[model samples]
Target: MQAKLRMVDAIIEVHDARVPLTGRNAYFEQNLLADTSKPHILVFNKSDLIDKKYRQPVENEMKSKDKKVHSIMWTDFKHKPMVAAADLIDIVKDSVTNMQRYNRDYRTEYNAMVIGIPNVGKSSLINAVRNRVLGKKGKATRVGDRPGVTMAVLNRITVHENPKIFLIDTPGILAPKAENIENAMKLALCQTVLETTLSESLIADYLLYYLNKRQLFEYVTEFQLKSPTDDIYELLFHIAKSRRLINKSDKDCKPNFSAAANFFIACFRSGRLKSDRFMDFDLLNKS
Candidate 1:
C-alpha cells in the first residue's frame, strides 16, 4: 500500500457514514498518508442511512483530532450521483491546490487513489463519479454488497477529461487486530470484515446488544415480540416462529435459530431496518 501511495496525487478515504469513526484501519495515518505528503480527503458514503443532524458533528468530531482531515463530505452515491460527483471533484481540487505536488508537480493529468475498508462503497463511488462527471453511464469497476469484491489494487481509470482526472481503486484494507472486542464486533456487525471472521450467532448477539443498549427497539415490532430481550436465543426463536420458518423432525418441531439469526443480521446489513447505525465513538466523544 505504501508503494502505491507515491503513484497518486491525492488520497480519498471512503468510509461508511453509518460507522463514521469506528473500525477504520489505523495504519492509514502511520503508513500511507504520513509517508506521502499529499492531499487526503475523507468522504462518508451511505449518507442517506444516517440522520442529517449527525453529519456535521461526525465531521467536526473527526477534525478535532490531531490528524489533518483536508475535507469531509456526506454522500449518497446511488441516489444523488451528480451531486456526489460534483462535491467529490470540488474537494479533490481544493485539497490538491493547497498541498505540495512533489513528483506530481509537472504532471498535466491528475490521479487520485481511493482506499477504505471493505463494502464501504469504494467501487460504487468511483463508478458514480465516472458516470456523472464524464457523462459515461456504466460501472467502471465491479461492485458487490459483500466484502472483498475488489480483491486487488487496480490501475488508474479515467473519471473525467478537460483537466484529465483519473482514479485508482484499491482493495479494502483492515487492521490485523481490533483495538478491542467491541470494535471487532462493530466491524463485523457493519460487515466491514468478513462474516466468516465471527460466528453468525455471535454477531447476532452483538446486534441485539447494540440495538437494545441504544434503545432502538424497532426489532421488537419487526419480529412480533411483546418486548425487547437481550437473550439472542429467545429473540431468534420468536423471529423464526413469527416468520414461519420452522423445522420439524418426525413428531418434533423447532424454530430454526440459525436461519432466523441470519435473516435478522441480513436485515440490518441491507438497511432494511434503517440500521447501518454507528457505534458510540469513544475517541470522538472524548475529543
Candidate 2:
C-alpha cells in the first residue's frame, strides 16, 4: 500500500456505516495520512443498513477528529440514485484540486486508492461511481458479500472520464491486534473478517448481546420467538426450529446450531431483523 501511495493523487477510505467508530484500520492514519498528508475522504458505505439519524453527528465527529480528511460522505450503493453516487467523484475532484497533489498537481488524471478493512463495499463503491459516471453497464471491480473479496491491490479502474479519475481497489486489512474482544466481535459481526476467522456461533452470540444491549428486540418477532431472551443458545434453537434447520435422520431431531447461528448472523447483516437494522456503534460510549 505504501508503495502505491506515491502514485495516487488522493485516498478514499471506505468503511462500514454500521461501525463508524470501531474496527477502522489505524495503520492508514498513522503511516499513510501522517507521512504524506494526501487529500483524503472517508466514505461510509452501507448507510442504508444504518439509521439515518446518526449521519450528521457521525460526520461531525469524524471531521473534528481527522483534520487530514477533506470530507466525510455516506453512500448506500445498494439503494442508488437516492444517494448520488457521482458525488464521490465530485468530492474527489474538488478535494484534490484544493489540496497539494505533490508531483501530480499538473496531471489531469485523478488517481485514488479505495481502501477499507474487508467488505465495507470498497469494490461496490468503485463500481457504483464507475457505472454512474461512465454510464457503464457492468462492474469495474469484483465484489462479494463476504470480507477479503479483493485479495490484492488491483490496477487503476477508470471511474470517470473527461477530468479522468481512476481508483485503485485494495484488499481490506485489519489491525494486527484488536483493541478489545468487544471490538473484535464488532468487526466479526460486520463481516470485516471472514466468518471462518471467528466461529459462526461466537459471532451470533455477540450479535444477540449487542441487540439486547441496545434494547433492539425485533429479532424475537423475526425469529418467531416467544419472547426476547439473553441466552444465545435459546435464540439459535428457536431460529433453527422455526426455519426447519434441523436434522431429521436422528430420532432426537436435533437443531443444526451452527447453521442456525449463520442464519441469525445473515439476518442481521442483510437487515432482515428490525429495530436497529444496522449494528450501530455507540459513539458516545466508545472506548
Candidate 3:
C-alpha cells in the first residue's frame, strides 16, 4: 500500500454504515492517510441498513475524534445507486477543491483509490459510479458477500470523463487481530472478517448481545421467538425449529443450532434484522 501512495490524488475510505464508528482498518492510517496529503473522504456505504437519524451524529463523532477524517458521508448501494454515485462525486470534488496542493499539483486528471475493510460496497460503489457518470452498463470489479473478492491491486477504471476521474480498487485487508474483544465481535458480526476466520456461533452470539443491549428485540419476532432472552441457544433452537433449518430432516430430530446461528447471522448482516439508527454510535462508544 505504501508503494502506491504516489499513484493517486485522493483516498476514498469505504466502511459499512451499520458499523460506522468501528472496524475501520488500522492500516489505512499508517499507509494512505500519512503520505497522501490530499483529499481523504470516508464514505459509510450500506446506509439503507441503518436508519437515517444516526448519520449526522456518526459523522460528527468521527470528525471530533479522528482529525484525519476531513470529509464523511453515507451511501446505500442497493437503492438509487446512481444518485448515491453523484453524491460521492460531489464529496470527492468538494474535498479536492478545498485542499491545498502539496502533493500532485501537475496532474490534470483526478486519480483516486477505493479502499476499506471487506464487503463494504467498494466495488459496488465503483459500478454505480460507472453506470451513473460514464453511462456504462456493467461492473468493473467483482463484488461478493464474503471477503477478498478483488484479490490484487486492480487497474484503474474510468468512472467520469469530463475531469477525467479514475478509481483504483484494491483488495480489502484487516489487521492481524482486532484492537479489542468488542471490536473483534463487531467486525465479525458485520461479516467484514471471514466467517471461517471466526466462530459463527460466537459471532451470532455477539449479534444477540448487540441487539439486546440496545433493546432492539426485533430479532425475537423475526426469528419466531415468543420473547427476548439472553440465552443464545434458546433463540437458536426457536429459529432452527421455526425455519426448519436442521440437518437430517426428520421432524423429531434435534434442532441444528449451528445452521440456525448461521441463518441468524446472515439476516443480521443483510439488514433483515436491524437496530436503532444510533446503534453503533451508542454501543461502541460505551464498550
Candidate 1 vs candidate 3: the TM-score winner is 1
lDDT (Cα, tens digit) per residue for candidate 2, span 1-287: 89998888889988888888885689988887787777888888888887888888787778778888878888877777325577888888887667776666668887889888889888888888888887888877898988878888888988777778798999888898778878888888877876676889998898888889888898988887888899999988888888899877768889999999999988887778865855545753462
Candidate 3 C-alpha lDDT tens digits along 1-287: 66665777788999998777675776888766865567778989888877787777777677877787767878887787988999998877666656676656787677778889888889999999888888888778898987778799888998877678888899998888987777888777777888787787888888788788888898877876778999999888888888877778766788888899989888876668755533366654563
Q: Backbone clash tally for model 1?
A: 0
Q: What is the C-alpha lDDT of each candidate?
A: 0.82, 0.82, 0.80
Clashing pairs in 1: none
Ranking by lDDT: 2, 1, 3
Clashing residue pairs for model 2: none
Candidate 1, 100-131: lDDT as tens digits: 77666788888889999899999998998888
How much is the lDDT of residue 75 in candidate 3?
A: 84
By lDDT, is 1 or 3 better?
1
Regions of model 2 farther than 4 Å from truth: 81-83, 248-251, 278-280
